[model samples]
Target: MPLTKEDVAGIADYARIALTPEELDEMTAYMNDAIDLLEPIRQYDLEGVEPTFHPIGDLSNVMAGDVPDTSVRALPLDAALRNAGSSRDRCFRVPSILGDQGGDR
Candidate 1:
């Protein structure tokens, strides 16, 4: 069934969105057009076809597995903190973006 303006308005209401009359009408047309485009797929005959979760089927990791290199050593804590503008308790300190609720981190 085609989407009506009222249906779109209801959806907008459910989503806590306030749409103008013109926007509601446009959204209704857009939703109906999308549904119409997919309507042709309903005519396909796939009685024995299994539903696929992944389009490419079962795929293993395509990237190379992680292999630790003993040649490369981790940077010392003192060296790592040397260039830091601010640090506290062996960790780099950054200004909290979540306001005073996050406290002084």
Candidate 2:
């Protein structure tokens, strides 16, 4: 799991990022050290450990206090589309995510 400079460089390229030589060396060392720390963690023998999946110790008020407001209300289908930039068959129309050339499908 010792990551090399070439591995770091390839990662940067795949992520569409540019990194200086100094940054590349730093990233490689940091990642290799992280992997070394994780290597010992994977060897733990947890055959009878009960799962405590939730992180919350107490179910206290985790959300903001509700406040009354006149601004929020359910809107009729047609009323909701009043200010839409564009629509087709009463549905909002947006540009395709894969661009004008069409998707791989």
Candidate 3:
């Protein structure tokens, strides 16, 4: 089924997004188009195909492992916070980027 403007608007509202009427219409059309594109795949017959986790089968540690360097030691919390301009309860207290009204600062 094609997505309606109300459906798109509801999805936007659920995600805390503020979209104008024009944007809602555009997004609804776009989402429907994407769904239509994937509709052709439903006709394929794959009754016994096993579900795959990765597209390129059995990839083992493709990226470098996290091995800590022994030469450099981690700084203590006090030492780390020594140069900070403001701190509270063992944490850095930076100025709020979000305003009191929940808008941008």
Candidate 4:
């Protein structure tokens, strides 16, 4: 079923958002607009047509022959290191972005 203004407000609440009344009205309109835009798809004659995730026809393996190729130098070491936000001696340094904290769920 299509969503309502109350539905949007509930979602925002779940996300812990502090939305103003104007924002709620805007979100409701946007949601309704999106639902209205998809109305034509419901009217489409898709009978006897196989639903495909990809728009293109069935793909066959088109891989090239496995051959040893010479490695091309992409960039100089100094430039590559400089491009990184932080780096150590010849290695790029990065903060721990992922992985669970030291505890079992």
Cα lDDT tens digits for candidate 2, 25-94 = 8899898888888987779998997767567755667877677565888577788788898777768877
lDDT of 2: 0.81
Residue-wise C-alpha lDDT for candidate 3, range 1-105, written one tens digit per residue: 888898889999999999998898889999999999998898889899988999988987787769976689978889989999988778987778665766433
Ordered from best to worst lDDT, the candidate numbers read: 1, 3, 4, 2
Q: What is the C-alpha lDDT of each candidate?
A: 0.88, 0.81, 0.87, 0.82
lDDT for 54 in candidate 2 is: 67
lDDT measured at residue 104 in model 2 versus the true structure, 0 to 100: 28
Question: 68 in model 4: Cα distance from truth in Å?
Answer: 5.8
Which is the better candidate, 2 or 4, if ranked by lDDT?
4
Residue 57's lDDT in candidate 4: 62
Greater-TM-score candidate between 1 and 4 = 1
State TM-scores per candidate: 0.52, 0.41, 0.49, 0.46
Give the higher-lDDT candidate: 1 or 3: 1
The candidate that achieves the highest lDDT relative to the unseen native structure? 1
Count clashing pairs, candidate 3: 0
Candidate 2, pairs of clashing residues: none
- Per-residue alpha-carbon lDDT of candidate 4 for residues 1-105, written as tens digits (9 for 90 to 100): 768778999999999987899999998888889999999999989899988876666866668878745586557789888778988788887666676566432
